[model samples]
Target: MKQDQKPSVVLITGGSSGIGKSIGTFLAAKGFTVYGTSRNPSKFENFEPFPLLQLDVADTYSIEAAVAIIEKQHGRLDILINNAGAGIMGAVEEVPNDEILKNFTTNYFGPIEVTKAVLPLMRKQKQGLIINITSIAGYMGLPYRGIYSASKAALEITTEAWRMELKPFNIEMTNVAPGDFATNIAAGRYHAPVRKGSPYATSYQNILSLIDNHVDDGNDPQEMAKAVYKIIQTKKPKIHYKVGQFMQKFSIVLKRILPDKVYERLLMNHYKIK
Candidate 1:
C-alpha cells in the first residue's frame, strides 16, 4: 500500500465466479497481484480480470500445484482467501448421507485443505492473512438448510482456533460470515427432492422456494469485496467479520441474548414451519 512497498500477492479459491470473482476483480483494481482458482480453468477462456488456475479445493494435488504456481511467479504469497464452497438443502432425515458428505467436502474440508497448502508460504513470509468466507446461516440452523448451516458453522468455529494458533507466526486468520448475496449458488445447491406423500414434502418444498427467493433478492457481492479490502488494510484484523443486511446480522445478536426456545421459535416463525 505504500509507494515504495511491493504490491501484495493474493490467492482466492473459487474465484471463477460469484463472490470470489468480485473480490479478485476488486483487489486487482486496487493493485494487488491476484490469482483465482477454478476446478477447470479451460472452461473460462474469457476470464480477464485475473488468471484462473486449475485447482479443485477437494483435491490436495490440485491445491499444491496451484500454490506452487503462485509461489513460483510471485515468490511470496501474502494473502489467501478461502472462498471456495458449495450449498446443500434438504430435510435432515431425507437428505442422503453421501450428499451431506459431499457438501462438507466442498464447504468445510475444502477450505481447510486450501488453508493448509498456503500456510507454509505464509509461515515462511512471517506475515500473511487468511480470510475464510463463511455464511451467516452458520450462526443458526435454518430448517431445510441444516447441512449448509452446519458446514459453514464448522468453518466459522475452526477459524477461531486457527487464529490463535497462527498468532505467533504473525499470520492473521479470520472468518467473514456473509448473508445471502445474489449469485448462482441457489442453482448450484444440491437439493433433496420433495417427494410426494413424504412427511416433510409440503414444508420442504415451501422452505426451498423461500430459500431461493432470498438469494434472488440478496445484496451485491461487491459489498463483500469492500469488507475484505477493509480487513486487509487493518493493522490487526479481528477473529470474525460479518457483512449483510441489518436484520440478518441482528439475528446473530438476538440469538446471543434470547432464550433457546425463543430463538428457535423466531426461526421457525420466519420460515413458516408449524
Candidate 2:
C-alpha cells in the first residue's frame, strides 16, 4: 500500500464483548476499519455491520490465524489493541499453580504472542500503535484478587519496557490502566481455589461483597472507549494512562509515594482483613 493510500486498520483481541467491544465499536465509528478477534464468533454481536475474526489469545495457533487473516486483507496493521484478558479471583494460596498459569497465559502471554506476530508487520510498515488494556490493579493490588493483580502487574511492567524498545522502531506502545469500569469482568471472574490451610476463605467472601457493590457504580464503558480513542489518535500519547474514579487515581499515586509497609497496612485496613 502506498503511504497516503493506506487506511487506519485496528486489530483488537478479545473484542467480542466488554471493554474490548467498546473500543472496537468506537474505532469502527471513527471510520477506521476495525477487526475484532475472539474465540467465539457468537460473542461478536454483529459481524455484518462491522467485522469479526475468530481469535483466541491463549492459543498461539489462534493468534497466528487471526493475524494471517488480517495481513492477507489489509497488508499492514496500524493499530493493535491487546484487550484480551479476564480476572481470576482467588487467594494466592488457594489458587492452584495451573490456575495461575491460566491467568498469565491469557493476560500476559496471550498479548505477547499477538504482539510478536503483528510487530513484524508494523516494523515493515515503520509505524503502528499497540494499546494494552491494563488494570488499576496492576498499579495497586487488591485483596482476594492476587492472581488477577499479578497478571495485570506483569503486563504493565512489560508494556513499559516494550514502549522504550519499540520507540526506536517508530512503533508506539500505550498502557491504559483503567479503574473499575462496568464490565462482565466480575461476572466472568474465574474462581479456582484458596491454598491449603489458607486463612483467606472467609475474607475472600467479604471482598466479593465489596466488588458486587462497586460494579454497580463503576464508570461507563463509553468513557473508556473515548479515552482509548484519544490515546490512539494523539500524535504522541502518554505511555501510561489512568482513568475512572478520581479517588482511585489519588490512591494509586499515594501508593507510589508512600512506603511499602505503609501501603500494605493501608490496604489491609481498607479491606478490614486484619
Candidate 3:
C-alpha cells in the first residue's frame, strides 16, 4: 500500500460500547480509519484507536449529520456497520404499541435509514460493504422478546434484498446474526410494564431470568469483533454469518431441517418458556 493512500473508512453506529465499540477498535487497530457513533458523544470516555460521533439512529437528522461528518473528513466510506439497536421484552400481546414501535425504530428503521444515507456515497465509489448486526432471534422469535426478534428479522430480509439490488453497483450487503454475546445489552434491555395481576407478569419474570442467565454465559464481544474483521477482509462475504455458541449457531441449521413444531418445541425447552 502506498504511504500516501488513505486507509479505508468505516462507520459503525451504536459503537460507544459493547459489540460496536469492540468492532470499531479492532478494525482501527488493523489499519482502517474507524468511527463509532453514540447518541451522546460526551457520555463516552473511551474509544481508543477511533473517534466517536454523535448519532441517534432513530432520528433522521442525527443520521444525516453523522454521515455528513464522515464524508467531510474521510471523503468516502468503505464500510458501514449497522450495529446500533435496542430491545423490548414482553409477550407479543402484552407489549404496548409504543414499545413495539420503539423497538422497530431503533432495530429496524434506524439501520434502513443509515443505509440509505450511505448508499449514494457507496454507489459513487461503486464498491462498499454494509453489515447489519442482526441476531439469531431474527431467525426464530423468542417467547417474550418478540418485538426485538421481529425487528431484526425485518432488517435481515431488507439486507438480503439490498444485496441483490445493489450488486450492479458492486455494493455488498449482509446480515451478521449473532446469538447471545456478553455485553451491556442485559443492563440496558427494556421490559414491558407488567401489571400485578396480569397473567403474563409471573411468566415474564421467570422467562427473563432464564434469558439473562443465558446472556451472562454468552460469547465474548471481542470474539465477535474478530469475526467481523475477517468478514471485512473477505473478497465476497456470505449473505448471512451466524456467530455464537455451538448450539446457538447450529439452531439456525436445525430450524431449516426440522419441522416447525419440532423447532419451536426445542426453542421453548431451551428458554424454559413452557
Clash list (residue pairs), candidate 2: 93-195, 94-193, 94-194, 94-195
lDDT of 3: 0.88
Residue range 58-138, candidate 1, lDDT tens digits: 899999999999999988899999999899988999999999999999999999999899899889978899999999999
Tens digit of per-residue lDDT, candidate 2, span 165-233: 999888999899888888887777787654455677677877877876777679988888999888876
TM-score of 2: 0.93
- TM-score per model over all chains: 0.98, 0.93, 0.95
Candidate 3 segments exceeding 4 Å error: 1-5
Q: RMSD, each candidate, Å?
A: 1.3, 2.5, 2.0
**Model 3, position 48: C-alpha lDDT score:** 65
Clash pairs for candidate 3: none
> For model 1, how big is the CA root-mean-square deviation?
1.3
Candidate 2 lDDT (Cα, whole model)?
A: 0.84
- Native-referenced Cα lDDT, model 1: 0.92
